[model samples]
Target: MDRTLTDIPTAPTDRVYIVIPLFNDWEALSLLLEKMTKTVAPALRKRFHFLIVDDCSVTNYASLPTDTGYSLSIMRLWRNVGHQKAIALGLSYLADQPETHTTIVMDSDGEDQPEDIARLLEASAQKPGQIIFAHRTKRRESRLFRTFYLIYKSVFKLLTGKAITFGNFSVIPPNLLRKLAHVSDIWNNYPGGVIRSRLPYQSVPAERGARLAGTSKMNFVSLILHGLSAISVLMEATAVRILLFCVITAAVSTVVITVVILLRVTDQLIISQGAIYIVFSLFIVILQAFLISLLLVFIVLTYRTQSHFIPAKQYGDFVEQIEKVY
Candidate 1:
């Protein structure tokens, strides 16, 4: 039987594990942890457990104070595997714990907003089966970043026929914890993997919060890689779209070339040097288009033959060590 949030009731004493992936941003993380005590409601505070996953931080997070009214623990990874993978590893760890009923995944960077946790919990309580996402109703990023983000979203929709607007700020019910742990794509991209997994989720409106301190780690190059990873999960769909585009271009070029040749041969129209140039260009385009289409077909065929790991079954290979700190 498939599990749902409604299948499990949360008592006032039930615990909610908030999984936060950390790298070197210990300052922001400390502040966020401190803010959670006051920002989160008092009743909910009693049941909150902060599961901070350290992605092999160079800076020591061990000294950070954790006596802020809620129970706290940090799970250190073997090495830095980026934020997305860190979150996956954290979820994989929590899935095995019988005491954990609900898990919230968010960034250590304050942009996820600790204040919105209340709203997310409220939505989850009202309707129990689906995962809840803190959808950004407004952003605090620069104009350049916003422009690139919009472009990325457009290209993603064009290639995959799907849309993604949420990030790591999401609440997962117990039912999805184990299932998501099994999705290998989460190792690369969390939001994309969840979308590909076909998990039912609802979004709550929230404004993006500014970082408490320091510059963002996501530069232009990293942003491009992040966007490509999202597209990579829909590789078959994107390849098919590209292949179809090549076929359409080849067909259109052939027809235009044929018409131009016919007109020139019949002497109905004057074929200048420019017209001759266009005919040759169309031929070259047709040849290249067919070549690309053939290559894409072979790639799709090759991808199907490769074996991939299911995280729930093979996640141990990635972990170096697990530590608990309170």
Candidate 2:
């Protein structure tokens, strides 16, 4: 399905701190917050606060609303980090806040659906101390996109030994913040990190909502990068898996070459010139596969030794400015 975030009807919660990242989508953000006002319970109107991470958008920030009951804060980054990194920074910013509160990570462009927040809140109430995610039961993307998405998911599971069932639309309980904020993998992909961490998590089914105000900047290339980013979070495991596959390929090829030579020598079969060439060519494949496996092993070992940037500690370095707009 083709979606232009022009206008759409699309959530509830405690003093939930809603964290959203934006890039030239001020109008959609404004409309999303407006809908959020009507979604939460009446008694919890002021309880919902918002933290918007501006990814150095060239668009003016003054296009946002000024008067709202919700407490809104904008954290502007020095450079354009993607939404995944922006979310990691936002979580790090709130790492030391009240432990009784919960943080909601969602999209501002309306595909996440504000109305479904109520369902998430209710689920969170029932399962305290666990992360809750909005699982898409139905998607509205084009058929081609869905096909690629399915392939991505399959590859992710095969490489990482874990299934990715959710995205950034998640409710993270504050009790886990101090620890999770420091997790390095979230800088690449939030949901992937959560899965990799082996944290307690649950999902509430939601249908994908239409975009709110403008066309999405997401294209095929960006989508592919998104998949790669998610997979990258488990680089060590992926490397190991690939290494094993390469080893298996080389072993099988060696066995085939041995059998083909033995059959010809024993006069059990007459090998054609093309067949002989093909059998001998396995040596090149075997050598290449062995070299690739060795490289992967070196990568996995090196990755284990290198120090990485931790979000909770380094996020402040990327923050340029922060303002409370409402």
Candidate 3:
């Protein structure tokens, strides 16, 4: 697939849609709507539409204010399919619409600045086929959270060999959006699919802000689950890394063994220390080699069996049903 962003007409049209995934932050949602109405470019304001995909929040937002002077629509999911899935559903909905040439996905909590939308639009206009990712330059989060995020980024890069620090805040052109809509293994990869798609894309630095309303829905458990799911997406690469480590260990063990035999022959071996160290090191090398080989075999089997794969159609159907009723 050709993943390249091409510059297109910048004339404002009724083709851009801003989609926000919400799960009960009515106050912040309201604020976000208000900010967007005031912040969007005048030429594009009349043509742009706002889509709020409700992820089964306990509170009913059907009666909330909708008079934002722009085309506004709310799509309530039948159940909570999580944030990522909800975003996918919103994009899918827009993808089905003929006039949607570009779609922007953002969080409803106002953490993602509304003013940045213009920058995204400009970037998209410069490179029509690219997805403009809003990467946070400075975070207002706690130190511990920042540390964890750094670690996650490091591991993600090591495994996937791609540097992606941003999350869901991005503007995807219609064609790329359609491609993502058909990605069957999206749930397994989260944002990995975006990078792996290798479509023309660019990243713009933005500052992170505190939540504009209710408490964050993400907890420790949810974060850990998300991390593990991301890791699973890059399992094949990780498996290769494990194999490499095992090979290195084996090579080191061989060299150590040769050195030990030489020392013994030359009467240069420290009898007690040399014997114990060599034996322990060799045992660890053998054990790690076995474990790594087993892990590689398991990953291959899982990939072949499609054990953890979730088809995109199934995900789409599930979300469609959720959008049908309470």
User: Where does candidate 1 clash, by residue pair?
Assistant: none
Q: Per-residue CA lDDT of candidate 1, range 180-248, in tens?
A: 888888878888888888888889899999998778998778889999989988888899999989999
Local distance difference test scores for all models: 0.81, 0.81, 0.71
- Model 3 clash pairs? 3-199, 3-200, 5-129, 5-130, 6-128, 6-129, 77-322, 78-322
Query: What does candidate 2's lDDT look like per residue over 1-326, in tens digits?
Result: 11111121112334678889989899889888777667655556566677889999999654665433457778889999998999999898888443336888999898898888778888988997899999888887889988888888898999989888788998888788767887899999999888777788999898888888899887788888998999888998899889889989999999998888888788776656755986879989999998998898888888789998899888878888777676
Q: Whose TM-score is higher: candidate 2's or candidate 3's? A: 2
Q: How close to the true structure is residue 168 of candidate 1, measured as C-alpha lDDT?
A: 91
The superposed Cα distance between candidate 2 and the true structure at residue 275, in angstroms, equals 3.9
Lowest summed-lDDT stretch of 10 residues in model 3?
A: 1-10
Worst 10 residues of 1 by lDDT: 1-10
User: 1 or 3, which is superior by TM-score?
Assistant: 1
Each prediction's number of clashing residue pairs:
0, 8, 8
Cα lDDT for residue 93, model 1? 76
